[model samples]
Target: METTSKGTEDKGISRARFLAGAAALGLAGAVLPATGAQAADARAGRAGRPGRGLTRRGVVYTVGAGETPGTAWDPARMRADVRSIRHDLHANTVDVTGDGVERLTATAAEAAERDLHVWLQPTLGDVPQRDILEHLAECGRFADRLRGQGASVELSVGCEFWLFVPGIVPGETVLERIENLQNGTADPEQVQRRLTAFTAKAAAVGRSVFGGRLGYAAAQDDEVDWSLFDVVGIDYYSYHEHPADYVRELRRYLRWGKPLAITEFGTCTYAGAPQAGGMGWSVVDYDKDPPEIKGNLVRSERTQAAYLTDLLSVFESMGLYGAMAFEFLSADAPHRPDDPLHDLDMASYALTKPIRDRPDDPASPWHWEPKDAFHALSRRYARTC
Candidate 1:
């Protein structure tokens, strides 16, 4: 992996210069009008909506690692790490999983020492409806843990359930399962009713816990039940064909009067190779395979960097609230040696090569190294903050 110094100053581009540059790049007509001055101001840290800011105050935490410190809760070490990350990255928000509440609370206290925000990406197992009430009840019980630690928490009940449901189950079976899970029966009509009921219940539960502010992460556009969330969260791996498209999508969501966050956004370096561990949901591979292929899609470091730059640019222009890269490190295990075709096959592709050490090692090919994209994003965040 190649390391590059992050430039401290903005590569000053005036409106006219920006237009000229866009025209030269054949994007002037396509992006200028839709992304007007308001958006531009948002990016520039000038005029912003109530909670919108260009500061890159975001970090994505893994289930048992990354932000969590030590085998157990070593308060001193956790505080040091949290302070280091916040000071170094200018991060204001750190995402924590539900099961990791104890560690999350510990980290939140550390964050409080540094004055940062915390968002909880609560993990509900495959069967959310099985104990939806119980799941929510636990969240209520945990709310005090968050408040006690001097951290405000946004409860993310489910992540990417859309992929697990309709993406995997047949339509008829999908309806049946939804019905069974929601209402204790397998009737299609009941399925729709249950979904509606669940949305209301979830929203009510969230409002009671977070004072009417709730967040949810969705992997696909279709998975979003907008009525259930105050803020819409999305995880995009390959949706960004270009930077302009990213801007357009953000604008679409911004119109809803709700803030938008790119909860998880990163490119897989492997292209089309099967994800090493079959751990994530992906649409393509990086090895120049046809879109229909089921594997990791490999893109060069330069391409990845450019994509990230464009993404950040769009986020700035659209007045987006914030974004978190998919991860800070690589997976702990190699592609599951026993099942190469599993969902996580593309897991290793998310990290930069240097972090991984040996990108070619299949057994433990997954490692965390900062690639050009990481630096680019870090620099961008540093500047904006």
Candidate 2:
């Protein structure tokens, strides 16, 4: 379960929708926690490797500029958003994920200009595998160009291929495929084999074009052959259903001796979200014309804020290479304080709430208000290092 927060509405796939089913099964009975000596070694290993983890704090930003009406992607607005990420959230790194090669690389350039480390992730869906491969080639070329200019840039080829890549999973779209996984129709063993094969080829393609760091954002279900990557990227979100010792679970990734990074980790804005983890976004009802959260999910920015600091503590204890908050902003999920049903931001994992456009006041400039999670990250990151 790769707890995705891609928010790739621009790609014709609702990121939360596709990922909801993946996190449904939960880790309660699936994976047991390491105890006794195993737990002690996990802690000992972390302590022995001093100064090896979480040297940088970061956040994820999706840029689907001009791809959709609801997506907030004005170049001027994005520049300001990047400024917020650096100055407000105090993040030293930024993971840029989305479809367009130009937009993805352009956002990386923005982060580079600000002296922030950049992770360039090209997330494409519902497209041919060849097209995806081509997209990766272009992204690598651009990332290498950034590196040539002395920018700290790494290329994450893609994420959670079991759902995004067409044939790896059972269904036609990402959502359907995930539902299949949840329904026990998809073979986990078959998915793993295909995932490894696809990742090896993707890593090779990335290395061929890019000279900097290369990796993939793996899901919890993926058994990645880490030898192909320069870094181990995992999207970590604690499952509230059955809490496992995160330190114990993460220790396995350390075996490779590569820098381990949490490429995505964050909860939604509503109550009980901290427990739901990645599936917190499942509350949204997309069938509506404008789309909004389902039923009565009470909004609680405090819940989101607490989830942030708690996970940061765990990441620090484990000493990760970096921990990027699932996202900085969700353009597709706008804030509607007056309308709870229509407050799409409630299900969003973004730190900031993008205000939906007002037909009555079209003259008002594009704007978004930072949620409490944003402040929590700022305080924690500012104190860090």
Candidate 3:
């Protein structure tokens, strides 16, 4: 999710202007009215035509992740989140990503209870080949367990292996790998060869134990051999310079003859965040003890909503398998009510505002409020084609 000198930065679209455009397009008012019958009618309209308009409407529910504080493991909260996705967002799938096996299995099981397909992605960050295989086997074990429970699950072998895992590329840190690639120090041919070899091995090991769909979150620019898996997955993010090519670039996946999954895509909660994919994570200065905005940035929830709606349209129009929003929430980047201007949560790609102080019993479910994107996504996903 981090990049070097790709020259792709936020284009700084005016929030007010984008919202004005959305209002004119009727997207702002497209949210389903708060009534169960109306929602059911809207959903029934699409029942006849399946696999249209992101049939696998999905969001990545990240837990126990590295950069963001792990969502506290609560089965009740997990059930609520899954139900919310199925009922409110009209999503049929959940990309349950995390590191630990226990949390990953529990999340997948809960999503299964809600009848949502699960993309089980476990992060084994910056480890060697042996460790990677070990993690893959662990995922396979959990996938089998979930299957025994009759849960639908797909095992993502790993994410961005060339960048994060060792032996595949020559860099001590993720940033270092990016620097090497930019400086012509990392051989492209050698890197691709190592990646292909390692990925093939991962798929082989994963398939041995995991009896379900398999794929890797290949970086958009990476030349991955897709024959090893059932799904062609890409962590696609729009760039400022290549706005028009977004759909055109994704069409190449059709050549793989596998289900195309946009494994990750989403915008931050700012005016220009739609185009902030490549460099969004790097924009903030994290050197300080507590990260804050690097400069004055305008908060525009509509920009994110617009970006998501447009991308969903492209995915649906193309008749691709499915896509997952980068994330449902960023628990660590909680809202800053006191310093609203410095609320880094606004920069989060998540569709909800993470609240830190839970004003109730310690056992109360975690509280999070939705953004405009959440409602917009619900409306868009509810449509048929």
Score each candidate by Cα lDDT. 0.46, 0.75, 0.67
User: In model 3, which runs have C-alpha deviations exceeding 4 angstroms?
Assistant: 1-51, 65-76, 240-244, 358-366
Judging by lDDT, tell me the better candidate of 1 and 3: 3
- By TM-score, the best candidate is 2
Flag regions of model 1 displaced more than 4 Å.
1-56, 64-84, 98-100, 107-109, 128-133, 163-193, 223-227, 238-242, 271-299, 333-368
TM-score for each of the candidates: 0.60, 0.87, 0.80
lDDT of 1 by residue, 255-349 (tens): 44677777766544444322221222223232332112253344345555665566656666766777776554334222333333432323333
Record all residue pairs in model 3 with backbone atoms less than 3 Å apart, i.e. clashing.
Answer: none
Residues 214-333, candidate 2, lDDT per residue (tens digit)?
A: 988986535677899988898877754322466666776687689888898898998888777656776766656656577778999998898887878777876778889988877666
Tens-place lDDT digits, model 3, residues 135-209: 779878888788777887888887767765677667764445555655567776688789878888988988999
**What's the distance in Å from true for residue 184, model 3?**
3.6
